[model samples]
Target: MRELRIRAGYETLGELHRASGVTVATLSRIESGVQIPSPKTLNRLAPFLKVSVEDLLAAAGYLPEKEEDPNEAAARTIEAAISDDPELLEFWQELVKRDDLQLLFKQVKPLTPKSIKKIIKVIKAIEDAEATED
Candidate 1:
């Protein structure tokens, strides 16, 4: 966790606190191995660190380490990416409901954020075109 925080460019707990809104004391305790972060804390920190909450949970021993399903992982990735945008979240919700696009989620797991945004934009365009046709 310390390594990840440093790699994410937070040189000090104060810096992380400013960016993530997690208190420096909590960050210090977690990094010093004196405390394990709760799931809510992990959720609050994961986006700033560019990691998944599940990865943090597994590392903190809350979850057993194992291979994750690609589709499920991709869904989590997409959900995280769109979490701050209501319109994108709605589009994502709609996309996941379509059986024909289920395989697309598996393929998206390894994509960069820019690529994911492009895919979502394409999906939105397709949906708009279909709506126009109807």
Candidate 2:
């Protein structure tokens, strides 16, 4: 953990304090794994440390991975990417549902040259649509 923090160029505890608004003592405790931080503190440290809370916890051996199916893994990956924020999760769930992306993502088969060209065309159409907006 110390190595990761250093490699991320945290420089000093003061740097973490300045960025995370967590006190030196608190940051030290977390780094040492002598204490646990609340979600808010964890969130603040995540970006600056260039690490995920889950990864940190895993490093500390406080968390374990659970087996999941491919679709479940993808959904969890999406949720994890958004930090599981309720609003973002709802938005993502709704966005995928509205566009029916979940079903499509599941049904996508091995890509061939023809299919790749079709995908490029679809992406170009979406980009053109967005580019038309002011």
**Top model number, lDDT:** 1
**TM-scores of the models, in the order given:** 0.49, 0.41
Write candidate 2's Cα lDDT for 1-134 as tens digits: 56766888888888768877889998888778798777667667778789888866555556785445666655555555554346555555655554546685577565554543455446556756887994
Q: Which ten residues in a row have the lowest lDDT in candidate 2?
A: 112-121
lDDT of each: 0.86, 0.66
| Candidate 1: Cα lDDT at 132 | 100
Alpha-carbon runs more than 4 Å astray in model 1: 1-66
lDDT of 1 by residue, 46-132 (tens): 998889888888988899877878777788888887777789889898788899998766554477766777788888988899999
Q: Number of clashing residue pairs in every model?
A: 0, 0
Worst 10 residues of 1 by lDDT: 104-113
Candidate 2 residue-wise lDDT at 96 = 50
